[model samples]
Target: MSFHFEYPRTIAARRPGEFKPAAPKFHVRWQAPVTTIVSDYIAVQRQASDMAAERAFFQRMRRAFDSAYGPDSFEEMRQTDEAGMVNSIVVAYWTDIVRYALWKHVDSFNAWFRSTEREQEAVGYWRETLTVPYDRMETIFSEPYYHAGLARTRQAALEPMYTAGYFGAMRDRLPISAIDPLNSPYGETTPEGNYAGGPVRRVRVDVPPNVVSIRSGQVWQKAEGEQLDDYYQNLQPKLETGMAYLKEHPETTGYLSLRAIVHLDKDGQELRETSKHGYFLALAQLERWAAEHKSHLDIFKHALAMRRKYGADRQVVTWHEVFVLGTTPSLEYINCHPGTGLLRFANVWGNPPPSN
Candidate 1:
């Protein structure tokens, strides 16, 4: 019913005749002031030639992964179906200091990783990390940025570019934050706090591949407390109101892809509610909405606090994304807490969850 492989003998026993390349040292160069790293990790258990084969492979693969990584229905990591396969990709950013550390010691890290027991257990899974460097040009800002309580593995080293001269400006212009080398989509560990660091740059993506055909999907959370009843009731009204707003503004044209409703909670209390609309040419419109109807944002936050007070539960919202085979644009949302509502935006859409 299942298959496993023994650790490769050649990797285990390195003969003296083997030529082990010396580990390369990282070099610190004053190149780009900003760097972004995107990481994609995938697990493949079985393969098939066609749809029938694909489905069968998926079933077997799920079973295999479940057996290997799950028991008593416990999950270490979670996955979602993408365009064609299940995948997880995370984008993070780093300052020059962290980049220097990675570049100098990557070879040594890779060597140890390949020699690890986990490497021995990997059957068909493969992981790849990609880094991109960008140059920051111009920025239009509304507020100062801040990041707090980041996970240990995901903390970024913020290296101020003293040489880049981003410190000051004369009285004629608005204050702007620009990275000397602005790297988008950098892969860093997730911060433990609710907010992402920085003033938050919003990006508009071209189109989404995953949620194109999907019109709706089910959302669930462990049902508990009075919060459960009130949360969903509040969400139902918000969804209707939000969708009505989008439908009224359907004629607009920028990054129209999907609508995502994020229902987040604190403990058993359902506290946060965010509705993201994948717009088409609505970048300017989104900013306008936030500016004009700031009061609505207050109502939403109050809803969250009310949910928290009653030991409420998970709130759910159904969504859709626009996708086209040739050229469909996309958008992403990064919601700020009580202070700013859905303040920052990114280009990523329909990214799969990470496996534990």
Candidate 2:
């Protein structure tokens, strides 16, 4: 199904947060020196003996990336070969934080990991890491979808809601301690509803336009036998539960709209020189026939609200640096229907991109 959004205001905060740093998904595969089970086990055992050293090295590495590339630096997209012998690929969202860090450090990282010292210490845990930046990776698109739809008639006059009531109401959801007009990016304003609160949860607004895009990151630290066993044991059940929930509520059901993002570009002058990825075509509409389905819409809103509250801390496996700042209160906007014709606006890149 196809959807459209229109707004009189050119600047309005979004649900969950005004702006989220782009975190492209990733898939990494490296060539291991020992593919055989005995050799691989022996290598892992050696690495296991020195897991602390690797972790400490990565901690320092992460700090450097944060200092030089910013928090969203490692939000690269990753994929593993579902088929045999395919090269593993990493598809990262191209942000300055990511670009600079990868451009500067990836080669160095490869050199270090493959050095005789590291390989001898931690076998089988890593091969050589390869990276491929993607405009929009497929893993995210393959997941179930959730979002709001909004449309306003053309006659709606554009205005700036940068400091309007909507923002104030959803102030709690802002990422920063508070909205500092002098320093913060406009997109990082209060309206975005922290990292989790959306229009329904934070402020009074129409249902947001469908979620056309998303980016995310994950990290797996090297661990030894006992540590790995304990960690995975604790993690697997949660992952299983979450997967079960998604399986039960697949995108094909409910008020869901799925889009294939075709293009992505960084915030820049002239705008044209920035990155361009792909176009989106709606693949399914769970709410297509139910234009007036408030119940189904509420279901999605409820799920998101819960996710914002619990997913990040307990269920989700995510990179460590990024955090949810605040959330918008769950509130709804009531539209006084006009004489049939309604105002509409198009999808736009909200605020300026986060400065790395």
Best TM-score goes to which candidate? 1
Query: Which regions in candidate 2 have their CA more than 4 angstroms from the true location?
Result: 1-51, 63-107, 127-239, 244-356
How do the residues 21-70 of candidate 2 rate in per-residue lDDT, one tens digit apiece? 23222121112211110000000112224545434543544444444332
lDDT (Cα) of model 2: 0.23
Tens digit per residue, CA lDDT, model 1, 1-356: 11111222322221234433232111122232333222211223222223343244334333432322121111112222212232211112223335434533542322432343433432223322222221111111110121111100133322221121111211001111121111112112111112332442221222222111112222334334654565467655555565456435534312233334332231212223333423233223433343344333543454446535532223332222111122222222222111121112221332334223
Model 2: per-residue Cα lDDT at residue 132: 17
Write down the TM-score for model 2.
0.24
Best by lDDT: 1
Tally clashes: model 1: 39
> Once model 1 is optimally superposed onto the true structure by TM-score, how far is the C-alpha of residue 71 displaced, in angstroms?
24
Candidate 2 displacement at residue 98 in angstroms = 10
